[model samples]
Target chain A: MPDKFRGNLLALAVMVCLYERPMHPYEIVLTLRQRHKEESVRLNYGSLYAVIASLLKRGLVAVVGVERQGRLPERTVYCLTDSGKEEVHQWMADLISTPTREYPSLAVALTFLPVLSPDEALRLLKERALSLETRLVQGQASLQWVQRHGLPRLLWIEAEFLLRLTEAELQYVRELIGEIEAGTLEGTDFWKALHESQELSLGIILSEKAQYPEETGIRAGGQGTAPRKRTRHG
Target chain B: MPDKFRGNLLALAVMVCLYERPMHPYEIVLTLRQRHKEESVRLNYGSLYAVIASLLKRGLVAVVGVERQGRLPERTVYCLTDSGKEEVHQWMADLISTPTREYPSLAVALTFLPVLSPDEALRLLKERALSLETRLVQGQASLQWVQRHGLPRLLWIEAEFLLRLTEAELQYVRELIGEIEAGTLEGTDFWKALHESQELSLGIILSEKAQYPEETGIRAGGQGTAPRKRTRHG
Candidate 1:
């Protein structure tokens, strides 16, 4: 019932692992790695014990017993309590159900990309396409491995989501690159002027249609007409 | 240059605005809001001044002059420095070009969903589908508004990306719901036994194939034959 556990993915993963049965922190780590849950859960081995301890204090998990294996150190095994089980379901439900606001850094960057010059933008975007190409190849290989090993769809659905997003970025960037190379990108004139810090008439407006509030419509000492209409594919 | 400004999206936006011409912070805020950059740049009005101060100290921006409008307080206008112009291009380039590690919370939750019972998962997933449906509707309206207003594609590309992603999530969630309702989810049997805490045999392996290292596999005191092969659509 405590709000502290909310959004703590590691704690959630820990509880989920224990739900299968009682597990020592070491086993939890190994299970997560072997299952390839590593992509989703970024865990610190040292902090995992701390996460389990906090769960114990919160009564979400109970220390069922200590186990010793073949000359190894004694490990405290933990089990998910009934409350823990309920919490996992509710937490996962909230997480998967809700569309939260996330500030993906690349998304933010792309939104403000007009700040850069066309050539510079093209150069960097080319770099991006190359990076994405490499990543796509790697992603394809890993996805195939998941399929080859016959893992459940539930296990690697996130990988598919990531792959889709990466593919989208690549496609968009490549198209933008093509537009830039062809000198057909929307607002190219305005962007080029700004990129070169060139002077223009007081009416030269870069934003299409002058749709922004008049007060915020930066005159920039330019008398400019509206930029050309552009579509997403344009 | 320094990596300090690599993730500073707000500063980047501010400088981008200033690159158009000298502007007061109020104008910067208005421009960002008017341009709908608020979705990507999370800014605190009070902290805008602090960000500007930091940028000034870092020589990315320099104050030009003060302007008084209609008895209002004289606002100090700032312009992007030459280095600032260079920085914006480099920063934008680096951001657009690099694929950073993003910890999307939804992706993390789905990876560990084995914690929830099939029924609970279905219930939560239904809730998710409903939320996504509402979001998809809103996103469609917003996209239409952007198109109707004749905003350039560069301005709303991020929104387009977001809408696409939301659509994907909705589509995937709906498919998952269908599978769950039909009682045909790949790991349903394995998940159900764990959900009910029922004893399963080793022959009842949850995954379609037993590919995990033996040492890390959770025996759970039951033998599981392999679960069925399930595709993303399955």
Candidate 2:
């Protein structure tokens, strides 16, 4: 699905892949790497498989059939559902026609705030919050799901992160509505702050872009897979 | 590429796309929708062709061959180059790795400000700034080549966005160094501002995630994508 799809990128990529051919996880990874390389694809075994499994549950993707071999675990050959195809097309059309805010991949989430009326924005937030809340509860519902699952320890943290964020959105939207109700929002600091926030984000974005000098050729720092030490998961 | 990738989501998505099959413009648009629907990948026809041609020239992607059907224009199949592959991987890897200051995206940029200097932070910013300068030059050269072709009107705006960004970076870097030279930065509003800005941005990010409400579905404002007096593209 294009940007208009209003979902995640890797999920869509996974769908595109499944749509192309029913694929086992390993085969999917293989094809992704082959089309270009693992580096460019920015996919790894851990995140990749996790997203696949999630998609399977969402009904966007499913196991059309299975592939088995002697030694290794039986492989699940997944394919995009009709619903998934519709999601892709619907999103693509949205991209072409909508004048909605352009959401950036990771950090651009904030930019979408002004795109909707506060009510609509609040509704979307609540929707996301509910999903995150479900993930927080239902995901950790069974001890077996948590214990047997070899997800990054941070997987749990992501839900928590979402919970915090939605709570924050709930607060902000309330504040926004309060402002509107009170008629205090007109030319106020919050509005200005909201506006300035865009510049600040842009500034941050621009600054990041600036860090890379145009003249020099690629350096060691410029290449893939800069390793990490985690603090909190988002 | 991960969110940590130096480039934004769209740029990373485009890079990841090259890892797939070689695509002409229409195909690129189709491919993007087919895969990453959330990206809402949109391009004026000019930017699409221009980005592809530059990617080809930069060795990020290679033109394997071209095909011409009866009525349509020629289509060139562009494959990602080795360097492109490496860069993409680096971006992906960095997304989850490389812990630094809290909220590394903006903090990383601010670190370059001389006003914020501690010996270690200064050293980090210097290293980062130096690296950024190199990339900026290369990016500019790439944009220049893009302009050499009959450039699209909006495409130039994108190019200018990049260039102006680079210019801002250079300016900031210089300003920061000067601030370090002057004693004013240490006790200046910058310090307070830094703390406030960080709190705001981080708060916004976290709040959006945690505060966003659960979906109570809603519809549009009765009107569809209809033309209002000066609706979209205004």
Find the candidate with the highest TM-score and give its number.
Answer: 1
Summarize candidate 2's per-residue lDDT along B108-155 as a digit string, tens digits.
123112122134334444554565676567556655554454332221
- Evaluate every candidate with DockQ and list the scores: 0.30, 0.03
Q: TM-score for chain A of every candidate model?
A: 0.75, 0.38
Interface RMSD of each: 9.1, 20.9
Candidate 2: list runs displaced more than 4 Å: A1-7, A37-41, A95-234, B1-234
lDDT of each: 0.69, 0.42
10 residues in a row with least lDDT, candidate 2 chain B? B216-225
Number of the top lDDT candidate: 1
* Local error of candidate 1 at residue A200 (angstroms): 10
Chain B TM-score in each of the candidates: 0.74, 0.36
Tens digit per residue, CA lDDT, model 1, B53-73: 999998999989888878978
The per-prediction CA RMSD against the true structure, in angstroms, equals 9.8, 22.6
